[model samples]
Target chain A: MIIAEQKPIQEIKAMIASYQKILVVGCGTCVTVCMAGGEKEVGIIATSLRMALRLDGKKPEITEDCIQRQCEWEFVDALKDRISKVDAILSSACGVGVQALAERFPDKPVYPALNTTFMGMPEKHGLWIETCRGCGSCELGRFGGICPIARCSKGLLNGPCGGSQDGKCEVSKEMDCGWQLIYGRLKTLNQLDQVEEILPPKDWSTDRDKGQRRILREDVYYEQTV
Target chain B: MAEFEPKLIAFCCINCPSSSVTVCESMGMSIPTNVEVVRVPCTGRVDILHLLKAIESGADGVYVAGCSDGNCQFTDGNVKANRRIERVKKLLDEIGVGGQRVEMYRMSAAMGPRFAEVAREMTERVRGLGPSPLRR
Candidate 1:
């Protein structure tokens, strides 16, 4: 899932300082599971901002709302009534959701309250670790389910670098060497031979010339389905 | 100007902190009138939002009184509550609300006098800081 963390309160404060009536929006899908932007988080941010603004002697009207999926139009449309009333929006969702709000509500100024960090899963409760870079490629099959591009510090495809020490990456002591994990997993699966064959370079092209990647499924369009 | 009377909120774990408050009162110890006690099953139940709400609702000071470290009935409830308090404190400080307004205390049921002492200490600290900026 897409992982993110709330931006510092001061930065967020500065972004919405000009707006008196503000709406804080949270997304429920990815950010919810990752504990960055969710319904509960929405309450926390709104209440904190409310108190913070009051501390500055600003009498601002703050509202809190969350949708099932901020990336989708239908869920975002549920906030139309509330959006119309607010002078600005403080989006606690990921960047995608923030852009969606910006595109949908062209009139109101929408600001992001979170830094969309990476695609990851919870390493443990309250601890999220980045797992994927979304490099527009998937080669987990060759590495025994661990993508060197994402897990390796240098994104080394062939094997572990000399910097790997005691199964940990030299980039950070906390990071596990991606190739080490791959080798261990393959050994356990009795497929260590997979590492001997060097893999080819990844196809990095995802239509970079177009500026943004997109997917359009003509078969899944509503008119055709209906 | 009249003397500033700080409004305080205490989240006491039902197991120990709550009992300590009760024991303290039974022993004729007086808790500050400005401090309100809220009983919860455990300090771990005290969330970041709970602490923030206390401040947003004009609490000059907020604290969670839980079981002493390593003595929690739930094993680690107090530990979790402590982390939450620290996070809230940092967040409050970042927003210029003064994190000193929030605190965490460790006490068992038999520590009746200690509960009152913590209350006085917290009340005095908040009083020193004056009324919360968000106070209506």
Candidate 2:
């Protein structure tokens, strides 16, 4: 899911300082899973903004709205009329959602209230750790399931980088060496021979940097149309 | 006109003081001098941190008046607020202040008398509890 963190209150306040009528839009998908931009979070931000504005002696006409998936056009379209009513929009969604909202409502300025962190999963119930970089190309099969792209301080392929010590990365003693983890996992799976194959340099273009990629299931589409 | 006015109480959210601003004026209150009226869309929107900050800012008492349990406009917002208030109440106690210092009440905006009752009741309750420990 798209991981995000709420921007500091002071900074967020400054960004929307000029607008008295503000709309806080929350996303209920990735950002929600990461506990950054959910309905509950939206409410918290809205309340904080209102109090801050009240203290400033300016009556801010703040409103709150949350969409199921802000990245999707359909969900954002639902917010069209409401978005038009506000002076500016504060998106609690990840970067994608913020951009999507901006595109849909070209006239209104959309502000990102949350910092889009990375693609990650909940480490525990409330804690999340980065697991993917959306690098476009995935090589998980070659190196167990642990993603070196995100876990390693350097996005390395087939690396212990000589910086690994005591099963930890040299960049930080607290961090487990991604390569070490990959090595251990592969050994356990009896794929040690696979390590003999040197990993070619990563072609950055094929992955996320190549630009947006899409998948279309013609079978499913045909089934639905007929 | 007492020189030392009691702390102002704020009721925020639709689930809170369901009638919005009218309840204050009808209750013969004029923002309680110290009182700040913060309107929110739902009681669920009331962040637990906001409640803590209110107490931190030296509010003698803080009240979150939301829609009655069964009548919450946002369905479970009142319930969520109740749970959050309960947590904040515990936090208040942990900090050596009586958790009762903060409260949540359910009432529609039309209930002006009810609003006054809450105001008087909260004021008296705070008076009995004494000024906030944070007060100088």
Best by DockQ: 1
Best by TM-score: 1
Instruction: List where candidate 2 sits over 4 angstroms from the true fold.
Output: A208-226, B1-136
DockQ of each: 0.83, 0.05
List, residue by residue over A1-226, the lDDT tens digit for candidate 2.
Answer: 7789988766788899889899999999998888788997897677666655555666688899999999998899999899878999999999999999999899999999999988888878767878888776788888889888899898887677898899999999977888899899999999988777888888888675647877678766655421
After superposition, which runs of candidate 1 have C-alpha atoms over 4 Å from their true positions? A207-210, A222-226
> How many backbone clashes does every candidate have?
0, 9
Q: Candidate 1: TM of chain A? A: 0.94
Q: What is the lDDT of candidate 2?
A: 0.79
The TM-score values for the models, in the order shown, are: 0.95, 0.65
What Cα-based lDDT does every candidate model obtain?
Answer: 0.89, 0.79
Which predicted model would earn the best lDDT? 1
Docking class of 2: incorrect
